[model samples]
Target: MNERDLKKLKSKKKGKERRAAQKAERARLAAAQLLVNQANAQTDPLSKFPSFINYERNGLTSSLICKKVKELEPELLQWAMNLCKENMRPLYEKSNQGWHEDEKVEEMTEDAAWYLIVLDKAANKPLAFSHFRFDMDYGDEVLYCYELQLEESCRRKGLGRFMMQVLELMAFSNQMQKVVLTVFKHNPDGMNFFKKCRYDIDETSPVDSYEETFDYCILSKMNKMKPTQKTSL
Candidate 1:
């Protein structure tokens, strides 16, 4: 073929390849959306994992239950809120955002929010709780852990790690892309805890700039069983 004809052919082939890639991406994201929707519809994501319901080690015995915000009793919700404030208010007040009780309550009571609550079996009182949601983040389906607060008495025990493992199991079993959370930079203990659990700074986490630095960072643990393509930096 002549030079001009060859150039035209090459352009046409490139255009076709680009369109094909775009179509494939759309299909992939559609599948992700479907997975998230299915997960959100479940009344109890934890029900399927019977073994994870009970924590009976590290000298701390507790039972876990997962429920949507609407399903939670008023008193239980109040306790969770109180525990969150007890564990995090100081850290929140110290952060750039400061502590906003109203905003936090609103978020905790959102219709889509879910709670994985841990109760002390003997006393029948809550020891820890994690508020989370299955949603899309940065174009990927993720299990976003909003809060993982434990009562002071439960700290330093292995309950925190066990709860994290449960969250990971639920996230991956339901086909979520990953388990994501935000941790304050000032809370070294919190940051170190997640790091020990194998979480790393996610791609979407904000970076410090010369003008303004962030006080918090986003961390995530990707599902090794269902790997996704990562964009090159």
Candidate 2:
């Protein structure tokens, strides 16, 4: 074949290769989505409660209550608060802290803290076991986190790590550069968990803040992701 003809043939081959790669990637994503749907289908869905579901992780699912939290009255807020208190009381009191459980839920709304609950889908019941709080990280500069707890029964099941991964991705998606958290030095288990996620232990104390015996800092990875033309959801 002439050089031009050969070049045309090579170009066609490259086009085919690119198409094949794209098809393969799409298939991989489809398979992953199918697995998640299958898992959700197998588990019992939550009781269609308002503000009780939303912001679920992939492979995890929730009802649509999160869409209505802003309009939730005192009753819904009370339930969320109690759930947080019941599930997180151990960590709070044992760790030398007890937030205003009732008022805290309202404060989350008033102060921009998102109080989220994650349910265990694979259980006999829809287990409301995971709860967390995080304020928006303005421009990836800083992150303030609170009330991270997993039910004692749900411990050691990889839920904590899964939730953290989801939260960090969400944080980055929301334009956060760094995520920050503070934990009691006495809680070695908590410290170890943060360490596993590559957070640094900053021991600095801020004056006029809630005085704590030991405030080990939880620092996030410095994000260096440049914006791409392709948008991510």
Candidate 3:
């Protein structure tokens, strides 16, 4: 081959080598970035997860749960009891004097169930409450929900909506098919709130004042929530 042709061939080979080196370096950098991203994801699933909280709607549900766990530890019971006692009777009376058991004899109300909702972690008070557990047939297993007690102090501040959302997530995480709750027909504002949440009446009561008849509502969600705290890689 001519000297000129040989020189051209050497130049071409050098260019190809440089191109190959650049391509390999780019691949290495990309792979490194991918590893970093994957590692971060493994450590913090919350970045890709939904923030959810689990809470019971009523105060009585917690009492039952606490009672069952009474043998576990005293600290839990003390904290739970405080939350229940503080919000239990007064809150119930706020709803209606007869809506709940007399505070004095409430301990005897073993039949009453309680649910709890912990408000924002930063809030001065944690959302803890209780409710009765009704066996409403969701066409399959009986559904349970907190019949939230509307408090006089905290009422009308949009807490009901917040509590319901928290309860829904808890129910979903527990494999509950749906959540069922009741509002007195006289509670128009309460009924409106449930309607806004798209709750529908599933059953009506037989009619009594305290345990009175009201349109029962069933609010169903996809049960698709996976709390961020419990998420895994």
Alpha-carbon runs more than 4 Å astray in model 2: 1-80, 87-106, 109-111, 122-140, 202-216, 226-233
C-alpha TM-scores of all predictions: 0.94, 0.51, 0.42
Q: Candidate 3 residues 40-91, lDDT tens each?
A: 2232111232343333343311111222222324454345455445545444
lDDT of 2: 0.49
CA lDDT, every prediction?
Answer: 0.92, 0.49, 0.45
RMSD of 1: 1.8
lDDT of 2 by residue, 1-233 (tens): 99999999999999998887777656644543443334223222223333333434544443221212354455545555666677655666665445556565565456334434454445422333223233323212333456566555656555566556555554454444445676666578877887887777432334335663343344455445733121121
TM-score of 1: 0.94
Q: Show the lowest summed lDDT stretch of 10 residues, model 3.
A: 60-69
Residue-level lDDT tens digits of model 1 in 125-154:
999999999998887999999999999888
The model with the greater lDDT, 1 or 2, is 1
On TM-score, the candidate that comes out on top is 1
Error of 3 at 223 (Å): 6.4
Clashes of each: 0, 3, 24
Which runs in model 3 stand beyond 4 Å of their true positions?
1-50, 53-114, 119-123, 126-139, 150-157, 203-233
